[model samples]
Target: MHLTLGLHRAVRHEPSSVATFYEGRTHTFRQLADRVARLAGALRTIGVKTGDRVAILALNSDRYIEYYLAVWWAGAVVNPINTRWATPEILYSLDDSQSEVMFVDSAHKSKIDELREGSTTLEHIIYLDEEEKPNGTLSYEDLIEDGEPIEDSYRHGDDIAGIFYTGGTTGFPKGVMLSHTNIGVPAMTFLCEEYGFGSVSLHTAPLFHVAPLMYVIAQLFNGGRHIVLSGFEPAQVARAIEERKVTDVLLVPSMLHVLLDSPVVQKTNFSGLRRIWYGGSPIAETTQRRALEVFQPSGLVQLYGLTEIPVVALLSAAWHAPEMRKLRSTGRAAQENEIMIADANGREVPRGSIGEIVARGPNVMKGYWNKPVETETAIRNGWLWTGDAGYMDDDGFVFIADRFKDMIVTGGENVYAAEVENAIAKHPAVAACSVIGIPSHEWGESVHAVVVLKPGAREFTVEEIRHHCKDLIGGYKSPRSIEFKPSLPLSAFGKVVKDELRAPFWRDAIRKV
Candidate 1:
């Protein structure tokens, strides 16, 4: 299936229906379709070809939706750079994907000169904002107005649709190649689940992330009205839901906590909300209980998956009941997915035995761009090894035990330990360092670093280490807490034992993950 098929269906069925809302502006389906077609034509005029990569580095807005649809309409692969990425990380993704054209908004336009110098393939920059266009950058409105509307490119099936960059285990980033089928399957599946036609969905989560991006695609199929927020601010989210009568929203556990804690939640009326789809990280039982009281009519759902495979399993509202005893589980596999717990030898482990979670389905990503070896390792025997440790119960519910991968999910964003370790290792006063996730009530888990100072070297402060890492990584990926240790625990193989570092912090926790 083509990624743009939903947009075509929506426009044909309800041309005059409200399609998107951002700030004080609104657009109908016909208007959105017309703009998308013109933008696609403009892209072609600017030398964008079918299968070429187009990148966008901007916050969530109505324009973000347009860019996503326009790129797919143009039959080009989208390379959405993470908004939280540092300049080097952003440049690396752009260069790795060979993106010829990139769109930037007012918040990120200041780095255009540096990005241009660092990127090997970047040729054009489009300013996506109401503000005056910067010198040497193309104006977003002028391009749409000047170009002719074009027909859909009609790319479909196994054709590559987007290249999403995710944190790498090797202290770099991996460009995850997803085909039309990889994204379309999940979008279609959502129609049979909680989302339906005419649902008013809120886009508070970052659009660049897979979870939020998939939600956008799912809404397009149903002709739902999208209420776009620049970012997730508790006050803004609560006000939008109350004013727009938003029916659905997706948030990570951390975001949910902050929103519930904010004073605005109690004052806002969210009676129109039908579902709260939470994922990206596990939620604390205390937080979930509080949510039930606050959002009485809204059902709580848990979506379990990663960027590589967007749809795997979903814990429905019923399973969240206190008597269900499956509240801690990630729920059964999706209708189209086949999931199992596998041992090290690639053999399926018996039910109730903890093992690595493995899955195979149309939702699985095609591969990592330009990394055949890593692809083979990830998708061995037609199953995508998730690197997440979990077990399935007799009733098919999957319980998350721990993570096998050297990764952390803090505030729903994946942070590879090696990436932070690599950054900290660059400090002049540090002799050795190991990064790990510590139990956090606020972020679910927080990045923590254990360092050993070099002999005869000046003692380094937490502020100094954080300042050094700011230029190398995102603020969220940097350590929130630091511990100075004499040495790190090592295994017989001489590799740092991260579990040992994480043990003390999680000892009294309800869940290990």
Candidate 2:
């Protein structure tokens, strides 16, 4: 089936049902389908065709939603731009994808002239904002009015559907080539599992990221409505959920904290909320505890995956056991794939042994776009090496230790960030924490942690934090030093930007990330 079949199926099932609550507009599936068709026709009129790449640089607006469906319906691969990125990064992805056309929202519309000046691959531009291009460049709505719905170019079963670029702040980004089957398989995996398969999903997470996009496609395939938030605001999210009776919402750890602490948490009715799914970063027990208390009716589900795999493990709704609360472990693998830990030799490690996590499944991406060598290094012998330090317990639950990049090797001893983060999280004063390896002359690399203290809590010194965690975990695992910050810099996915945090430490030094 074509990826666009989801939209068609939803319209057929409940044409009049609300399909999207975006910005100030509400749309039913029928209306959405009509707009998608019109927009697709418009895209085609502007020379979009099968296998073509179209970039969208916009916030999570109603227009962005329309662009998603219309791009696919036009038989083009959707390349959603990371709006948070600077001009150079945005230009990199657009140039890499060779996207012929771009759709810029009102906010970023002003930057087009500057970006377009040096760009060679961008042949056309369309503005989704109210102020159209002073030149004859097309407006988003006008393109829809100028064209007709072409036949459903159902590029299913291995045909490329989307080119999702990884957030490569450290270096150049690689485009993940996802086939129709890759995403179709995962969408069906959730549906077959009946984990709120077809329910309203709030898009507080950036739509450009894989986590939210996976849900957007999955929920759509399962005949669910999507409530698109232009951008995440705790109060606004709570209000939308309360007003729409939203069934499910996805968050990463930091956003989870924001919601629990928001005044809206007390005022908004969470009665309609069924489940709260979180991932992209480790969930602190404190954050989870607060979340459980605030979003009472909503059960928390954690999913773990990399950009290459899209999604791999699902810590199912079953693991939310009252007894399992303190374990801090991701549940057993989802039904879609097999999860195993591999050591340095590429051999599977025994249960309870820590190693790199690997998986082999249909849901995994085809490969990195235009990077054969990197793709080969990541996916060997049909298994994708997730670059995550982890272990499987006797119950088959997978415990993630840390990313291969974030693991600190001090005097040949491997230290995990998750371990230090967990230990710091136990401190009564720490609201959130992150551990990163900084340049150290004596040990090669030393652990340095940055912490966010709870409001009104007295400041603790670096020595105090190190002394506290020295006994809980290994002495070597304790951070060599701690730096208290007002807050941690989190990505759109809510994962701490450790590389960014540590950049100043290695600016002129010979150290590797």
Candidate 3:
């Protein structure tokens, strides 16, 4: 089915139902469909033909959703930009994707001219805000107001739907090309699950990210209410949930903690909330327990996947109980996905053996845009090789150990950073921590930790941390050295940027990530 099929279905089934709630403004399905069709005409008027690349560089908003549907409505491909990226990184992606038309908000408008100058293919910029149109750019409202409605182009199945760029933690980001089938299969399967129909789903996570973007499609299919926040703020999210009676929301572990700690949550009634979907990183047991306390009635679901394959496995709410042994696992593979642990040679390994997580299904992405070599390297024999090192238990629950690159080899014994981080995080004084391999003349490489202490907590010595970890893990797995910081460096999606943490220590090392 086409990506736009959900929009058409929603319009047909509930034209007058509220489609989106954003910043005190509301739009019905009818209104959304009308604007999308007209915007599609506007895109065509500006020379956007079928298969043309159109990009949007803005935070979550009603207009962002419209941009996605309208682009697909015009039979064009959507390239959603990461709002947190640097100008140079943004320019690189624009040039690489050959995106000629871009939609820019006031927050990023100042860099428009420089981006245009730097990119070889970018030509037009649409001012995406309600404020006065910037000089030399087309106004978003004017385009929809004046342009005539157009027919749906019906791009479907293997047709390329969207190109989402990954965070360049290692180096430059690659554009992950996802087809309509890649999204639709999983979305259709979601309907069979507990994602409530006609539910009020809040979109606070950046819509550019694949996880939230997939929720958008899923909500469309369910003809549910979309509550769009400008971005994630603890108070705003708490208020939206209480005021709008939001039924479900998606958050990363970091966002979840902030939301739980927010003072607004104390006043908010969470009885209306049915689900709390979180992914992007594993949640600490402490955080999970706290979350269960705050949203007692809501189901906490864990999603696991990369941008290339959006839903490889889903840990349902039932597995999140404090006493459940599967709480740490990502849960079994989803209904339509086939997941396995594979070695470097692409051979499936025995259960409980750590290897690269490989997944295969209709939901797998088409390939990386314009990178055949990398595409071949990622997907072999119909399985997408997710660089995560993980294992499956006898019950088929998949447990992610760490990223293969993040695994530290000290004294010829392998150490997974995640295992060490979990132990460090358990220390009462530790707020957050990351483990990496640092060069050591004696052992060739030593496990090192960067930690952030809890606010107002007393400082502790490195020996205290190592002694604490030694009780839980092997001496080799304990951090050899410790550095205290106010905060850890994180990518836009909330994963710790290990490359930046390793750069200083590996500057002159023979091996580098």
Best by TM-score: 1
| lDDT scores in order | 0.91, 0.76, 0.84
lDDT of 2 by residue, 59-79 (tens): 887777788778888788989
Give me the runs in candidate 1 sitting further than 4 Å from their true place. none
Model 3 residue runs over 4 Å out of place are 168-170, 406-513
Off by over 4 Å in 2: 131-136, 167-170, 325-327, 406-513
Candidate 1 C-alpha error for residue 155, in Å: 1.1
Lowest lDDT 10-residue stretch of candidate 1: 188-197
Model 1 steric clash pairs: none
RMSD of each: 1.0, 11.2, 10.9
lDDT of 1 at 180: 88
Better of 2 and 3 by lDDT: 3
